[model samples]
Target chain A: MITTSALQVRFGDTTALHPLDLDLPGERIYGLLGRNGAGKTTLLSVLAGFRKPSAGAVLFDGAPVFENVRSTSRICLIRDDGMVGDGTDNLRDVLDMAAMLRPAFDSGYAAELLDRFGLTRKQRLGALSRGQRSAFAIVVGLASRAPLTMFDEAHLGMDAANRQLFHDELLRDYLAHPRTFVLSTHLIEEQSPLFEQVLILHEGRLLLQSDLDELRERGVSVTGPAQVVDDFVYGLKVLSERTLGPTKQVTVFGGLDDERRALAGRYALELGPVAVQDLFIHLTGGVP
Target chain B: MRRFPIARFLLSTHLPFLVMVLAGSYLLVAVILGVAVLVSGPASVSAVDVAGQVLHWLAVGYGYGAPALLATVVVHGRTRREFVAQHPVYQLVAAVVLAALITGVYAAEAALYSAAGWTQAMQPDRPFAAGDYPMIFLANVSMLSIALVTGSFAGVAVYRRDGAGALALVPAAGLLVYGGAVHGFFSLPFAQQGLPMAVTLPAVAAGWVLLWACAREVPLGNRVPA
Candidate 1:
């Protein structure tokens, strides 16, 4: 398990991440959702011990992680731009180096992932296309088999088909070996199904942390005559609204209890589950 | 084994390459000089001393190679953190290893010169006969160690200061003054192998300490304070 207590990151006067606390249980998949500059990457870096926090501590199993060989060796952070190797390094060299450095690394599995990604072992990573680089990074992250692995916008360069392939490979690998995985991505709708829990960040502060299903359940949209919709959403939390002629649709917080459902039925109004993407946009002020 | 992975990685990866390049370049120069002497005769090659040429090249190699190697490993994503974690001790070990390698190469060059019956024109004023090679090797190794450590210090200064022009000039100016002193001092008729060690070892120790200070607060990705 990883626990962060009052962690903060600041670059000069600009606060990248405000003081925040988080506890990540092991053997689970966490989806870290945020728009641009939402402190997702900063938080992940701090956890991985790649960047030191300005204040507070990040502990793994009750011990500090930064500069601790025992802790950092078990954590892996894969960035999207491929930060690990130089241009002259081939996939084979990279895998060999990883095997030597990462205690839990599996060479056979790494070879399998190389083949699955259609990357030749002898090919230089610098020569690969952007999508190929992303695939190679994903392969390294999965193959390292670190107990705590974090991926920060790791699939932004991949195409749709490759992205799907990555998701499939990730799920398959996680089922095979249970570990902590924190995936920070903006593709909320496409990846939310794989998340057991979700953490939302807005403007350098955490907005919410809840179960995936519970977060979705918290949003409900009511559509009906303009006056009825306005009256029903009144005295409740309204996220967004749209109007057409005499009709209105308002997305709001709080699940509809049976009484409100019956009231909707009596008013001849339509109710629907809010899309996770729409809910994210509403919460983050349409940053994405 | 796990305690000093930075030192191990650097020794495994960078040292071998540097050694190969140094030895190969020296041998190539030696072979070319041998061929030219054979073609033109010993009198024509009177001014061209192969042993002195090799020492000159070795000096150049350590002065530049040490800094480049450190910069490359420190910026690399895989090795940077470990490099920082195991710092001053790693550099001390690196200095000794690099010096030993250069000394070994010089020994091989001397043996090859003796077997080939090549004339060593620029004889030292010190007691440096074939039997006294160890003393001569120690003297040369001390100078090279000083050069390498100084270069490593300048490299970290440049890294911490974000490649500022002033810090980049540190290595160039240092090398110039040191090289000038080596030339001027050794040109004296009474110079011996013992004096250079006195100057070189203290400079090396100071340089190592400065390098540690320069590297203490360096963040990942070589970021400077805003």
Candidate 2:
């Protein structure tokens, strides 16, 4: 488990993270959703002992994490740029260094990942394309097998097929070796299926944390005739709306009570589930 | 708990490459000097006379290598403290190894000069006289050791503070000057051949302390996408 008590981070005059408290239980897959500059990277950097919190304490299983070898050695945070090796180094050199420093690093698994990603050990890190570099970062992150592994925008340059391969590999590996996995990404709908719980951040603050299903249930989409859809969503928390010819679809927060459900049934309006992406857009101040 | 794991890892990974480069550089310099001697008549200076150039190259190498190595090791789950503690061991070993190689080049050059009936003249400012291999090794080791530590300090300073961190080079220059003065590179009034350890040891120690201060709490910056 990881716990933060009044954790804060400030850079010059700008506060990156406010004094916030959180308790994150271990051995679960968590999706950290945030808009750009929402403090997601700062939080993960502190958690991984990459940086010190400006104030308060971050503890891993009741032990402080910053500069604590016992704690840091068990944590791995892979940022977008990989941070695995120098440009001059070859892929094999990086893997060797990782194997030497990280006790849990699985060399065989790393080799398999290299082959799966169509990367040769002899290729220099600087020679790989941006997408290949991201894939290589994923391979290192997964092969490290650290108890607490986090990836902050680590799939930025990957193509759709590579992203799918990464997600599949992540799920398969998690099943084989259960551990704490925190992924911070902008690909909400595609990645939400793997998240057991979701933590949403808005403006340097954690806006919400809940089970993924429960969070998804907080909003409903209504579709019918334009007039009826507007009337049905009247006085409700309307997040967003779209119209096409004579039909309209309006998404609103809060569950529909029985009377509203009956009203929707009587009006022949169709109700559907809202996507996590929609809720994220709405909760994060609606379309930039 | 592992003993100097960072040091061992760094040495094992980088030393072989460094040695190869050093050998290649030595061979290239020897060829150039030999050609010069053949074309211009008996050469006054031996190839090892210019071995001091290695000091600058080593400093540059450490300046660029330290931060990258630190990031790689820290991201791999090693603490900054472990890196700070173990890196000096690698630096010291590298300095010793490089000094020994330079001294060997001196021996090789002495033999070549003898065979060719050329004078193996050395610069007047150097700490060692011609044919004095022991003093040559000791003096080179002291200067190279200081250069390595100072380079690391400057590297970490730049890494932590970006543009403004270049100010560290001022102090780094001061340290290097002191190393040279004591090692007889600069003809200082107080420079004595056998008394260099008095200042050389302290300068190296001070460089290491500065390096630790700059690196201990340094935050790793996020790398921009390529």
What fraction of the reference interface contacts is present in each model, in order? Answer: 0.08, 0.85
DockQ list for all candidates: 0.19, 0.76
Candidate 1 residue lDDT tens string, A164-226:
988898899999999989999888888888899999987789899888888889889899999
Could you tell me the fnat of model 2? 0.85
Worst 10 residues of 1 chain B by lDDT: B43-52
TM, every model: 0.78, 0.95
CA displacement after TM-score superposition, residue A76 of candidate 1 (Å)? 0.7
Model 1 lDDT, full chain set: 0.69
Error of 1 at A202 (Å): 2.1
As for model 2, its CA RMSD to the true structure in angstroms is: 2.1
Candidate with best DockQ: 2
Report lDDT (CA) for all predictions.
Answer: 0.69, 0.86
Note the chain A TM-score of all models in turn. 0.88, 0.94
User: After superposition, which runs of candidate 1 have C-alpha atoms over 4 Å from their true positions?
Assistant: A221-254, A259-273, B1-3, B30-118, B122-132, B161-200, B222-226
lDDT of 2 by residue, B111-175 (tens): 98899898888877777788988888888788878878888888888889755377787888898
In angstroms, give how far residue B190 of model 2 lies from its true place: 4.0
In the predicted model 2, the residue pairs found to clash are: none
